[model samples]
Target chain A: MESGTARIAVDLLGGDDAPAVVVDGALRAVRADPDLHLLLVGPAEAAGEVIRALDPAQRARVTVRPVRTVVGMADHPVAARADSTVRGAVHAVRDGAADALVSAGSTGATVTAVALGLGRWPDVRRPALIATLPAVAGPVVLLDVGGSLEPRPATLARHAALGTAYAAVAHAVAAPRVGLLSVGTEAGKGDRARRLADPILAATSLPCDGRYVGLVEGYDVSLGARADVVVTDGFTGNVLLKAIEGAYAMAGGPPTGGGAPRAAALLGVAGTVVVCHGAARPEDVAAGIGLAAHLWRRRATDQVRALLDGTEAGDREERTDRTTDTEVPTS
Target chain B: MESGTARIAVDLLGGDDAPAVVVDGALRAVRADPDLHLLLVGPAEAAGEVIRALDPAQRARVTVRPVRTVVGMADHPVAARADSTVRGAVHAVRDGAADALVSAGSTGATVTAVALGLGRWPDVRRPALIATLPAVAGPVVLLDVGGSLEPRPATLARHAALGTAYAAVAHAVAAPRVGLLSVGTEAGKGDRARRLADPILAATSLPCDGRYVGLVEGYDVSLGARADVVVTDGFTGNVLLKAIEGAYAMAGGPPTGGGAPRAAALLGVAGTVVVCHGAARPEDVAAGIGLAAHLWRRRATDQVRALLDGTEAGDREERTDRTTDTEVPTS
Candidate 1:
């Protein structure tokens, strides 16, 4: 709802049906928001397709980076170092040409490119991909959704802090309650990582009036009954998000509010980045673009980073070895 | 459905709502199934309530086994050994007094009691809790729902075999395609455990014509579009099941077929057993009792065990140290 001129770099050669789907999505986004501008980073032909679809007035808002290289979904994260469109989009943000970037490419590649190009936050070892689900109560912020697939307890605790800030800053949830995702709501009812993370999360101080609400089950993620920000490892969060989307499909359609989000905002980095599903439809890519614009206009990335800095400064004495295993994102 | 006299031991002092929900579920099950007989194991007062609600003919099918001890959900699994109702129910199954047992108590307690009383299969180290989901294509059998929370690679491979055999024998799924649940369908898409278990599952031979379909996402669990049997760690399986149930609730109701199952069948034990949700309603407990009766009438436990024996005997060379960490069921 923050209306301003937000320039977003769109990776046109990203998704499975790239170029076409990305072109269609960019066109839809350009038409929807008058103040929104797009930096199309892909083949010139694909960028021209989007530009040609818009009227002369709308064409003034579109620009092209013209990068032809693309990363496949099966490529390794190191592949992002190549001259790819995702890397190009990240460069656009780093160079201040765009406020944010959106990609539907390989998650690992996008995460790596963003982290390397834009740099991660000072204390963030692994950047968390935060997906906000429209649950019954309100927006449920689920973190580490395919960003850091094998995060340690410390990383999970840090993501909890990040999610708490994101929920309050981006979604405008007051006094957000954070919970560690586990099999059961009991104190000692989860895997070894969860058992270790539970104590760490409880002892860690949260910003934005966010309180730690002990252990929560999967029901809390969808129902939003117990916690507003649900923290979990990327592996569980990724599969759980997809499972809920599939369940919605089986149940005919989503609820009155909306379904599981196809795009997630990548936090812990220096700039705003939104990642759509690799097999994203045109509308999903549009949503990703819209999310990027929204986050950029709100300055959510900088505000969340500042919030984390204050919390970390408050608890700096207890976080000496937190970044020992830094840069281990298993996407 | 298999029609036969199926006597099931009902744990009356189980679940959050305990005796009241247990009694209502028992009465509903007894009235619904003509050939179903129940041996209610709990306080005599709770048993009398169930008996008093039934007519003369139905009352003849109900019996009571008074056991004052109970295992709370927060209690350790070792609490089941203290003459608890779950222990009594397990003993009934072992002594041939009941065809199967149904409980809505602590999953750890039930698993511990059943594994100790009836004993695990010779080749099986961890007993799997299997929950069948009515998916779009057919029934998708998810194993290790709450039993064996943190299974090793060998245990997952073994559970894959057990799930495959159970799908063929219990659900009558012919040549069921089995999949190892992960974040993505790609070959190297999951965590360290999944990365190690993937190759092992591919090398292990399956029984009843079951084949490994490689890695599958969580959508396959609810949609059943890729595989009929999905294998994952109990921690992931447990949370995934509850999340699906929550999603169904958020979607207004379940599909015409059904929603996420509240009851899961315990396999690798010597007898048929059904463990309902810890916070089960009366209808959920009734569904658990009905599932127990169905599994017992079909002689699924015996049949699945025999099929697993055939599979293990054929692949004995590669599985010498599978039982090193046996009896580790972290519910």
Candidate 2:
């Protein structure tokens, strides 16, 4: 939808109904975005089905990277084979064949492949998966959705910066308010991880003029009245996101704006990567591809990285708590 | 509603809009259940208002335990004041004046007072707060909603048993299936606590012919198809409950069966105690009182304890792996 053309690498064997859903999603994506070009990564036969479906003019926007199954390897490990497709998709982004990548594969496989292929950002130990939920007030950015499960207090503090920066750059929010997710909004309301992270978030400087809003309850993730960005350990964040989606389904539908997002932007990694739910449908995969394209055109990653740099500099000058010493992993 | 008379102690000065909402709630509870009696705990003026509003026959069903405040105690801590109505309500249950107690007060205050006055059940460490959400399949019992904040792996396993027993005794579900709430249903899917608790739950013995069903995702809590009772730490459970409630509210109203429960039953304690949301309205408080009466009539607390005893005895005889040594703390 943006002015500039964005090329995205689509993983055809990523979702539960891989290849079929992925091909269908790719067709939808290409049809929706006139300025979008996709480099399909999968078996040649599946790629051929996508190419044959498009007319001459639309077909010109598509490309394929043919993959095949080697004979005499019928009993190969599933993990090894799954890792190949994700690695190929990551390599496409690294080779300048695509501006970004979209996958609905196992989050661990994608995260590992992406982090290894495209190095992590400086000062970020664990890459964060960020999901934006449509709240009543505005968008609520939730970080560590599934990238890293057991984040230390320092990793959480670092994610606070990442989330604040992402909220401003991706969502175009001015002076975003960040909050640490916990059971209650009161001080000392949550478990050990949250109690320790509270003071650290309060003391740490946030990017984009973002301010830490103490502890926020789960309702704030959907309602967004208290904070624009909610930070938590990946385990809690991932389950909470899915739980909200389920709650919406049980309630008949989502609120006025939208429901819980199926696609999440992988931050803390250098490249533009969008990870959809593993059980995502064709429409969800298409939406993930569209999100990746949008982020690439908006230069969201660059802007967020720059914001974090400024925040890091300010923090260094203001506080003398900077140290390489590791603290206990409370999460 | 049941055949037996159930007298419930209602905490008058417990919620944000105490006395006013509590009085209205008590009136609704009395009207709904012909055999229900209420022991209203608060000031004489507040009790007098409820007494004056009811008909002569209905007024005879209401009794008051007036809690007089000191004339010059403006600096008294409202939560710590020994003469607070929640403590009085707890005392009423301990003195055999009431079959159960219901409060929409501060959760911490209620938990502490109830544990101290009524005493905790043997072999139960931290009592769990259990909330039953009306899901598509049936009622899903979620435990440790707010009773204990950060529980160890053993505590989580114990809560699983507590939830399983609760689902059977309170909801009358046969062979209740229990699941540990986690990010994914895979074997090694969650953070440290869940990773450690998953195997323990799978091995632990469940009551009422209950069985442990490995890890369950967030959707399982709302759908109830995967497990009858979902177990998690109090923090996650608390937030999840509120988020579901908020989702139902945003959807205009709850589904046909009703919305996320505003009340939760307290387990691990000897007495039957029901806690409503602190921000509950008059009708929510009334529903919570009604729930307390219903559970009392069913003798849910005693039945759940007996179920636990049966399971523990069976475990000891089977010589299963009891090396986990996780004890549910009775506060």
Candidate 3:
């Protein structure tokens, strides 16, 4: 909806029901946004179908990069050697063929491809998959939904900064309140990781006028009254997000505002990237593409990286803490 | 309702809105269950009102244990104290003056009081709080909902057995399918604790003909198609329950079956105990009391303990490669 041209690369063979659903979603995205251009990256046949389906004027906005699956290699028993389409999409962004990328593929493969191709931000050991839930008060940003299963306490503190900056840059939430998701709101109300991270978060400096709000419960993620940003380990975050989605389904439908998102934005990489749920429908893929464009137009990745740079340097100046062996990603 | 005299000790000075809500809930329970007897624990004046309202026939079923507030003590502040009415209610069960006990106080305080007064089952370091939610397929039992915030991998494995037995004895779930809660259903999909527990659960033998069905995602908790009982650390369980409750509220109301439960049954203690949410309403309090009476009448706690005993001994006899340091409570 932003008044700017945004170019995004579409991974045609990335999802469980790829090619067909991806094509349908790309068409929907192209028709919805007048200023949007797409660079479809996949097999020539799949890309041709999308290009031919568009009218003359609409066709002008679309381009294709031919990628052929290696025959005989497909039957090879190795997962790593397969000609993955997600890798092709990552190469498109890395090679400057597209401003951003969207994928509905295996999260591990997409993350691996992006981290390898686009390069991660310096000092971000584990790039997070952030999802924004449309809560009652405003958008509640949750992170590490499926990025790294296990992160150290220092990594969690670093994520707090990333989440804070993302809320300000992408969602425009002023003076965002950041909270660590735990069992209870009390000081010592969680597991050992949370107990260690609580004090670390309190000591760490946050960017974008964000302040740490000790601890919050899972209800805060859906209601958004307690904090604008909720940070947790990827494991808990992933399950919690899906659980909220299921809760909405059981309740008949989501709140009038919206429900848990089926897509998430990958942060800490050099380029803009959005990942949809593996079981996403056509509409979800379209939404992911739109999100990729929005992030690219806002220059969200660069802004968030800049914010993190300032905070990390400030943290270094404060003290020479034991930074070694702390699995805090230094891209 | 179970065709026997069931006396329940109700903690009057528990919960955010104590005495008033507790009184109202007790009145409802007495009216609904003709064979139910109530031992109201709180100030004499609060009990006097309830006694005055009941007819002579109903009055016979009600008794009171007066716990006057100290002169300088803050009003309602007594509700949060560990030695208040909830503690007295626990003692009533210990003295055989009541068949079971119910409280809607601070979870930590209630847990500590019951463990000290009624004594813990030998070998059990932390008790677990179990709640059953009515999902689409059937009742889904979730455990450790605030009992042990940080459980070791062995503790989680122990809970798997407890939950499996509980589903069979309490809910009469036939050969219940147990699952370890995680971010994804695949192996190596969760944080360190979950990753470690997955293999242990897979190797361990479950009681009551139960089977370990591997890892389950959050949606399965609400859908109940994948597993009958879900196991997680206390922190995730507590927050997830509250989040589901909040989601149901945002959805206008709960589904036709019911909403997330306000009351959870306490396991690993030597007595039958049920805990309601701190913000429990009168209806929630009544439900907590009802759950306690039902558990006591069915001898669910005793039966579950027996089943666990047989399983533990069997596990020892097998002496498999997997070894766990988990402590099992001995009655």
Candidate 4:
């Protein structure tokens, strides 16, 4: 529905059922959005299949990079796989051939490639993978899905700021209420990491009129009755998302708002990038492409970066003023 | 449907909605099972209310244990609250007056009181809270829902054996497959704790013909397509269970297999204890009482302890034989 010439690079050999699924997803995306363009980055045969499947009018909107290599799911992220299709897609985005990139491959490989190609935002030690779930109230944005598996308290506080900014920019949420995910909503109810992160998140300032609503339970993640943005370590976030998906499957299907998304946008990177599930279906891959195009059109990555920078600067200034206030004159 | 009389001590002053909800739950539980007997452990007025509601046949099945103190949800577990209703319920089990105890109170308080009163099993340093979810295949047993929030690698390994025994003894899951919960199913796909616990679980000797599956994702927790017994830290398990419950609510209702349970059994303690969610409704409280009665009738606690002890002894003997085989002849 967005109106803009947003060019997206799709990794043709990424998911478990690659090439075929990617081709189908690419075709679906091209037909859904009139202002969308795709730069297929994979084997020539796969790319040609996509072009041949499209109509003459839609053929003009598709292009190909023709890379063959791929990063396997078990491969190391920083290993010598520079010529992989995902990496090639990242290069296409960096070179301005595409405004954003989408891959249903290894999450680690995609995160590494995007961070290396586009660079990370200032003051961000680790990039965050943000997934938005449609809840009863509205969209609930969860961050650090698999970006940093074991983040410290400071990293969680930093992610709180990123998630807040993303909820406001990507979802058009006003005055987002952010909450820390824990076992219970009580103040002192969690493991050591949560106990440490709770006070830190409470003290940290959030952008876009965002405020910390203190500790929230797992129910808050799906119900969205408590907070708009939920922040946690990547390990917990990743498993929690999958469990919700499985629960929806057990319950026959998802709600009217839709189930947990299979595609998540990688924040803290310098460019708009969306990563789909490794076992994604054609529709999931198409959703990933749509998310990439939407993020590119809205310039969400750059806007979040700018907001984070202002917040960090304000935090530093406040600390400096506090330090000065605590100082006593020796004279 | 269990024929034997199950004497269950009910905590009268527990949960967010106290005496009123407890009174309602007690009446429901007494009427549901004819062989069930109750020892109300709280104010005498609450016990009188429950007795007055029942007919003459059921009136003889109920008794009263006068206790004035109640543990607040935010109160510290071990700090001078020994006379609380949960503690009194534990004492009722310890004194042979009750076969099992159920409380819709603070999980920490219940765990602490039961551990201290009944004493833990020989090799279990931390008690485990186990919850069974009805899945497509059968019941999926998940342990450490709130007990031992931040367990060590050795604790997780010990819990794997405990979970295997529980699945077999409590749920009658023959040859249950145990799995360590992680971000992904790959060998090295998890946080540092999971990476350490994976190999430990693989090497652990299980009881009741249980086998260890390498690793399982969060989906396995609900779907039960991979493993029958899923082991995780209390923190992750607690949140995951609540999230699934919320997802079921979002989906309008649970499947025919049922939803996430609001009541969990506390294992590793010598006596049977069931802890209900702090926000439990009347039916949930009734379910907790029902679970206590079921566990007591089946003697699940004693059976699980015996199985765990055999496994631990076998593990020790295996290590001794290996040590003996590696010894060099100095002569």
Candidate 5:
């Protein structure tokens, strides 16, 4: 474990079994990590429940910032209701009351709140939700789990940079091999957006000395054989991740490495944030909280942002050089 | 296990490990089923290897058709070279020399070959490659595994009917619950294609009394908790299926029931066709051949086509009714 005090703001009523599961998860997280301090943002009673579960000495580690509103699952993501608990949690992080934040609410809401509170990194239109799956080679980082349902080709290219940096920053993977998820490994194997993004990714420079491994199949996401980082649109990535989890359950048990994650780290936003499953159990929430702290301590968001900035700067320079050179025939 | 003899043409030069794996799989399938007969399509040398492996009595069940051209993985699907082995296998079925066909070749090539040789079912511009995954509830039939990468809303509706009938005719599933695979179960929770297909499937009457369940997520495919037959675009289904297979492998091994099928049956074509993985091992090829035999004996393709024809007739009548009743205000 990293040796540092990480203050994490938790949404108290963001899940289906809100208040209860959130309280249980918060209490478990507080007990497990000694240096972890929590800023619970929701009903006073829910926050009190977490406080009561901790020891008298440990109670100092917990703080309450009461709020009442919640973003319902059925609600449209564009709404930024001021009283929402997720917004309060994001405020905590922005105001330096917390180092990071965790929510098991509607993913669209949490992502919106984070982007609104902390502001997005430059040139990143859609912040990606990255989930890491344990595989034989190593942890395979999959981006856009649910951030943007139908991203343009440029968004996919931006995500490749985010994923490559995240793999190196969060997972310490060196020279990560990035792959665009497709139906087959052969070129022109995917839909229109993927086919367009393939050549773009190949031409673009990736952070952390990462190399694009062209196209990869679904097995690469679980097996981690072809690429260390897998990039796809939010729709396919979201469904693919859940399918793998269901497969693990149907297989009687998960592999010795562990099953699919119930939590994902939100990237491209300027603050550290983790989104747990809406149907998150206590363990899932705890994991989400742990992930938030790990990311905060490692400064993963900041490091990834820096790498992207550097790559973009280099891209600008390359473009200038190419323009100065002679042009080839137009297609 | 069925009483009738199932003569299946095997594409010996189809897969990456062609000839060797195909030969081994044919031998295993012949040994496993007494009523099974194989018409091997490949080089004279490879066919001789299969003949030499079988006993004098078994030799009668094995026949060889010499063909030299092998479809390369990188080759275009439109290029149906005259001497292609996949074409030879398809011709065997057309000539009444085989009851079905099995190939571990490029999915697009095999699909094109089968469509051109035996011809496609009327109105099915794209034939679906259906794979049955053993889930908790029962066999969840997933369609368009690799047949149509990006199908229209009408095509998705067509596949729903195909899958519903398949679940009932092939697997004996009664009133199969059909669903459109999407990012979320909620209505309007997917890309444009899914949002458009949702109502089409809901209103379209299905044979076998199959009910259309609204949008289902990835978990529905592996757990089978939500639906019996899951439908998606060929690209998504293909990747989703492979992802499940990889997850099972990562989990030490498959479940007590089974793993995702490495072999999928081609539907909407005039004859029974099975496509194995291009990297198929001996066991996978045997499974593919076995699947072809099973499907042929059950007359699954014929039954499904009949069901579709009946459904389409009913649809035409409904459309005529709506037109006569007068159109409502256009959306």
Candidate 6:
């Protein structure tokens, strides 16, 4: 949708229902965005199927980089012997053939490939996967959707900073209020990890004039009346996102605005990379491609990095003590 | 709703909108269920409000147990100087004054009071809070919603068995498929707690002919296409239930099946107890009373406990390994 030509590397052999859905998704993305170009990374036959569907003008905007489908799950040891399409797509982004990359592959595999290929941001040890959901207040930014399953307290502090900046840089929210996700909004409410991480987030300085709101409950993630950016560990965030999606389905449809996002931006990576849900439909894959283009055009990565450059970790605990009201009202 | 008379002791000082909402709920419940009787445990003035609202015919079904409204939250230890309405309700059940009890008080306080007053089931160190969500497949039972914020791997395995039994006894779910909730369906996916709990759940012998379906994602909780009963730590389950409630709100309302249950059954306690959400409205409070009456009529607690008595802890590991098919495919 942006003005500049955004070239995205699409992993044609990424998802559980690969090639067919991927080919269909690539075609949809190409036809929707006039300034978008795609570098298809998968088997030539799969890429050819997509190319054959497009008209002459649209076909000229797409290119193919052939690679066989190879999964690299932790359970699959022999899977390492084969070259992966996810890695091949990463190479395309690294080689400057694409402005950004999008994949509906295994999240762990994509994170591993991107970290090894394009490199990670200097400060973030556990890069976060940030997803923006449409909420009543606006877009609510949630992070670490499967980036690091078991993040330490310090890692969570870093993610608080990352989420704060992402809300401003990516979504253009002014003075976004950031909150730590927990069982309850009340002070001293959650498990061990949350109890330790709460104070750290409270004292930590945020980018783009973002305010650190106190603890927020799970409700805030969907109905974003309390916080604009919600920071949580990957395990909780990942499951929460999926649970909301399921709830929407059970409710017959999503709200008029939209549903929880299937595409997430890989924050702390050097390049603009988007990961679609593994079980994503064709439309979800297209949305992932569109997200990659939007991020590439916005230069969100560099801007967020710049914002976090000078801010120190929360060491000023005295000023940030729980003397004030902390709970975001349940109702 | 059942044929037998169900006496439920209601805590008048329980919820955020206590007294007013409790009075309204008690009136509605008595009017709705002809076979239901209620013992109001709170201030004399609050009980009088409910009695004044009821007609002469309905007034005979209600009894007043006058106790001043006193709370025992962490915020107010001095508040404990007064008698707790929740404890009075618990004692009423213990003394055979009531068939079951319903409270919208602090979950920890209610659990503590019940465990001490009514006693707990053998070997259940941490009691589980079981909530039945209406999903497309049927009622998907979720447990440990706020009973034990941090549970050991053995505790989760125990809950898996408990949930399986409750599904059969309470919901009439035959041969419930129990699944340990995690980030993904894959064997190795999730946080440290889930990684440790996965195999334990698999090896565990479930009650009511229930089978362990391995790791289930958040989608299975709402959609119910994968598992009949989902087991998780109290912290995760607590937040997850709330998130689903918020999502349903965002989706305009719940599906035709029903919404998330505001009340959860407290298993492992030697009584039919239901705890409503703290933000329970008048309708939710009435629903809690209804759930307690339902549980009492079914003799659910005694039946579930009897079912779980013979099942040994999951010490037999060889028969249930990762080599077996774990993922329950979602359509």
Clashes of each: 0, 5, 6, 0, 0, 0
Question: What is candidate 1's lDDT per residue for B102-158, written digit by digit as tens?
Answer: 999999999999988988887788899999998998899999898988899989999
lDDT of 3 by residue, B1-331 (tens): 6757789998887778887888888888888888899999889888877788788899999999987532111233234444578778888999999988998877777777788888888745678999999899889999889888889887887888889988998888999999999877767767788888999888778998999999998898877879999999998888788778777777788888888899999998999999988778999999998888889888988998898898788667655432333344345
Candidate 1, position A76, lDDT? 89
Residue B258 accuracy (lDDT) in model 2? 76
Worst 10 residues of 2 chain A by lDDT: A69-78
- TM-scores of all candidate predictions against the true structure: 0.96, 0.93, 0.91, 0.97, 0.98, 0.93
A174-224: candidate 3 lDDT, tens digit per residue: 999999998767687778899999999998899999999999987798788
Over B1-331, each residue of candidate 4 has an lDDT whose tens digit, in order, gives 8889999999999899988898999999999999999999999998999999999999999999999898888888883256889989999999999999999889898888888888888699789999998788999999889998999998998999999998988788999999999888878999999999998888789999999998898889989999999999999999999989999999998888779999999988899999999999899999999999998888899898888888898789877876887895344
> How does each model score on lDDT?
0.92, 0.84, 0.85, 0.91, 0.91, 0.87
Which stretches of candidate 3 lie above 4 Å from their native place?
A68-83, A320-331, B1-3, B53-56, B68-82, B123-125, B320-331
lDDT of 3: 0.85
Model 5, residue A262: what's the lDDT?
87
Clashing pairs in 4: none
Candidate 6 Cα outliers beyond 4 Å, as residue runs: A72-82, A313-331, B72-82, B313-331
lDDT, candidate 4, equals 0.91
* Model 5, runs deviating above 4 Å: A321-331, B322-331
Taking chain B only, the TM-score of every model is 0.95, 0.92, 0.92, 0.96, 0.97, 0.92
Error of 5 at A299 (Å): 1.2
Put down candidate 4 lDDT per residue, A83-149, tens digits, no spaces.
Answer: 8899999999899999999999999999888888888876888889999998999999998889899
Residue pairs in collision within model 5 = none
lDDT of 2 by residue, B187-210 (tens): 777888888888878878888888
lDDT of 6 at B157: 86
**Candidate 2, clashing residue pairs?**
B124-B330, B125-B328, B125-B329, B125-B330, B126-B329
List candidate 1 segments past 4 Å from native. A317-331, B317-331
For model 1, how does the per-residue alpha-carbon lDDT over A1-331 read when each residue is reduced to its tens digit?
4579999999999989998999999999999999999999999999999989899999999999989899998888899999999999999998989999999999999999998899988798999999999898899999988999899998998999999999998999999999999988989999899999999899898999999999999888889999999999999999899989989999999988989999999999899999999889998999999999989888999999889988997677555545543545344
Docking quality of model 1: it rates as medium
Output the better candidate (3/4) by TM-score. Answer: 4
